[model samples]
Target: MTEPTDLTPSGRLPVTIEEEMRSSYLAYAMSVIVSRALPDVRDGLKPVHRRILYAMRESGFTADKPYRKSARAVGDVMGKYHPHGDSSIYDAMVRMAQHWSMRVKLIDGQGNFGSVDGDSPAAMRYTEARLAKASSFLLDDIERDTVDFQPNYDESENEPKVLPAVFPNLLVNGAAGIAVGMATNIPTHNPGEVIDATLAMIANPAIELDELMQIIPGPDFPTGGIIMGRSGIRRAYETGRGSIPVRARAEIEEIRKDRQAIIITEIPYQVNKATLQEKIADLVRSKEIEGISDIRDESDRSGMRVVIELKRDATPDVVLNQLYRFTQLQTSFSANMLALDDGKPRTMGLKDILEAFLRFREEVILRRARFDLNKARDRGHLLVGLVLAVANIDEVIALIRAAPDAATARESLMAREWDASEVVPLLELIHDEGNVIIDGKVRLTEAQARGILELRLQRLTGLEREKIQGELGEVAQKIGELLAIIESRPRRMEVMREELLAARAEVATPRVTEISDALGDQTDESLIEPGQMVVTITRDGFIKRTPLEVFRSQNRG
Candidate 1:
């Protein structure tokens, strides 16, 4: 601590270069670890992602557990892995596991998080939960040295930066996160297919993004919505990013056990579960949902039970139109996935991402060649062949060194050609290849022999070397593409954009002027002039806007 006289008014202490560097670096590291890398119990946000999946396997939150309040589950997460506030924890727990809540729900919530809308939970004591099947699968290999774990803030807890998340959690469960200059928004996938794709990747890390599609297919949203087109998924993965189009499952359901009506099984992936409900409530209050007899959150522990019970004999198509007309259920997800390149974050399209990954993989291959024991052994064996030829150099020189009467060394070796025994005449009586190499005065060691062979091989500059590099590069690209795809966000609501656009365009058609060639009538888009429009909005709910044409109309009317 410097004295007040030596320090400025800001209580500054002279920091050395080392201290400055160390402090600055540590601060950055902590920022990544605490805020970005680690998951918060409140929002279920890890530095890597905000979305999470929970299991309702056995100890799962059941409607039966004496109706344990939702608060209990939230409390457990807060006290354990996450130390955020209870409200945050509860919210995360509910959102992740709620069936009727998320369009592409991650968690398999067994108990209740409250209403499908933004309603608060009954109480902390009402809900309960356990590890989910998918969650357990994701965590299975955690202790196998397949993944890394770090200490918590107080060193009292440990968290896996990644779950060994074998199933491409980013894609399977979908994730959303905001880091310093980056964000991730990956969509959820079908559990079974995700597992298959993961297994495929592990079996041959060299698989292409296109190949992965065969295994995982497109996003298998929990809400069962439609992924209009999957062609962009490959490009997105290849480029480290791309958008997907998602849409709701609009099905005609029976009303009052008689008339047919449309029932929305899934909403847009981007719309918040809480926000969607509020919009629904507002519509009901506004009497815009005239045909809706009741909108009850029938979704219980078993499955999604969003019951939009309708009035008798209402047209289901019209109801669906109304839903699209006013709600968050129809939306768009803009994908801008970014991944690590050269140890730094970089935004990329699907193809670019794949290319970067491939390059990274090639580097790995080169590194392995220099490090892996088995590879080194194979390389050393090749050098043994070269040393055999070099040891007999003396005989060749003798033929050239002497007159024409001298014997030809080529004939001697040629006689033994195509057979290992041919070298026996030149090799003394050594059973081992190395013994002969030493006896012939080559003075070769295993490591040195391997090194020389490697240099020679690298100098080949031929098709074989290219083939090897190509294999390595391909693998690297595949892995990166997989990770990026998983780490990337999915576009769930994009499919309905054209529909929404057409609707909006119709609403904004600005009554175009047309010469009804016969009548030659003129038309205006709006009843009131842009500047002459006068609005009188009332707190009691009445809204009045003065029309511009009224001023020009005859006073007699």
Candidate 2:
């Protein structure tokens, strides 16, 4: 054949390149936005992060348990849930364990996990990890059908769609990511403050932003530093985007006679100490900044201390100001509160995130109550069957003896009806539907008959019989409590509040970052000495500054 006929469906219809490219690019962008880059508002986790936590929990690597090699957990996540590269999975897991990386670490690591100086972490095979106790709040009630589950990539296993987070994890531990055309850079907040804000919202659904801010002041970076002003924080909370200026904590100290030095204890969030030192050194070498006699890092286990000794005549304040102006001693954090909400990327304010978490937590509480109710009802049904068998012990024994086998005896038990007068009240209390009552008699269900057959001879003793009745009464009470939680909204809310308080007790800590009202503007004028200078402009328009003495007065210059 000269040419093969087109076998494609739609008769190989012709399409413009522009149309195809537009559709394909849009598909790819959505995939990245939903599947990878942004965190889910409910759990504050991307796919890789969620997978790592879930996998580690499944492997029994909890905080109380012994730590296992990180590579093992990474392998489990990649093979079962995430289906990604091992390096990416390990990197995500390591970040969760790093104290400086997460506001509240989700994982407790035993080995070295990098440093604030931007050093790389040790290999995953050498490091060990386990789930932190705080994670229990996120993972509790997961097995009770509180959240939905979807099949993994290869359809070989199932994983949760989102964790049944008790607290508002989205704001408590924040998140950062970059997608196709968007990115999120939400700063973390103190756990105690976040929980308080959530509780306040619950108490007053119509609470305004002003009232909420009173509870949660501003972002609390793990690397504690002073926030210069409140205006940026207000803008971010109101509109989900703003920049806050942060300055390192430094003090002028006299280390010798007639000489002073600058002592830096803390740096801006996400700023590397080593790089900052290098930048300062380069500026001094190029003579851009003057008066520094020596620079040394005296940081140790106690805390961070970068010492900048000054010349005898150098003004400590002036040199420190120059460092702030030319180095990373001062920086601004640009907050972009972007995350995935209901499978779409959204820019959410503080109120939007808290509201979403509340809605999700309510659903979790309802689902868990239903699950417990069903379980209690089932146990009560079995106990009722056991009681009947004990009441008619003589007849039951005779019938079993006459039967040829266990199967025939079970069928005979199912076929016969017994007096319902003794158990009718218990059945009503527990809401059990395993048996049917007609007039004054009821027949045993298949499940009940099998349970009776499996009963031991010792259960017929007087004390044992009394024990069974007592256990049945406890189960009945439990069933009624679960029913109330399911039927009434207020009862469920009370239960949720109690659980939240319990979680708060475990993870709450005092605020680390300090918020101040001092204004910080970008300028070098204040760092200059209080003296006159000569400004010269060339014919070509370049300008330069020189000391007044450099152009000494002459006869007629």
Query: What TM-score would every model get versus the actual structure?
Result: 0.47, 0.93
Query: Which portions of model 2 show Cα errors greater than 4 Å?
Result: 1-15, 531-557
Global lDDT for candidate 2? 0.89
lDDT of each: 0.46, 0.89
Report the C-alpha lDDT of model 1 over 1-557, residue by residue, as the tens digit: 96447665698877789999988987896576455543322122353222122222222443333434445555545554565566666666666566543323434454545554456655556665543334443444344443345765567766655443322344444556656545666555554554454445434657776787676555555555555455545555556466655555566676545755455656665555556666777887898776766666555556454556666756555666566556655444555554444334555543343344333323332333333323433343333334443444454344434535323333333232222343343222212243233232344344433343234434344564455444434444443343333333221112112222332332221111111112111133321123576566889999886665664473447
Candidate 2 residue 519 C-alpha distance from true site, Å: 1.5
TM-score, cand. 2 vs. native: 0.93
The 10-residue segment of model 1 with minimum total lDDT is 511-520
Tens digits of per-residue lDDT for model 2, 257-363 = 99899999988888999999999999999998889989999998888899999999888878888888888898888999998888888998999999988888988
On TM-score, the leading prediction is 2
lDDT of 2 at 300: 86
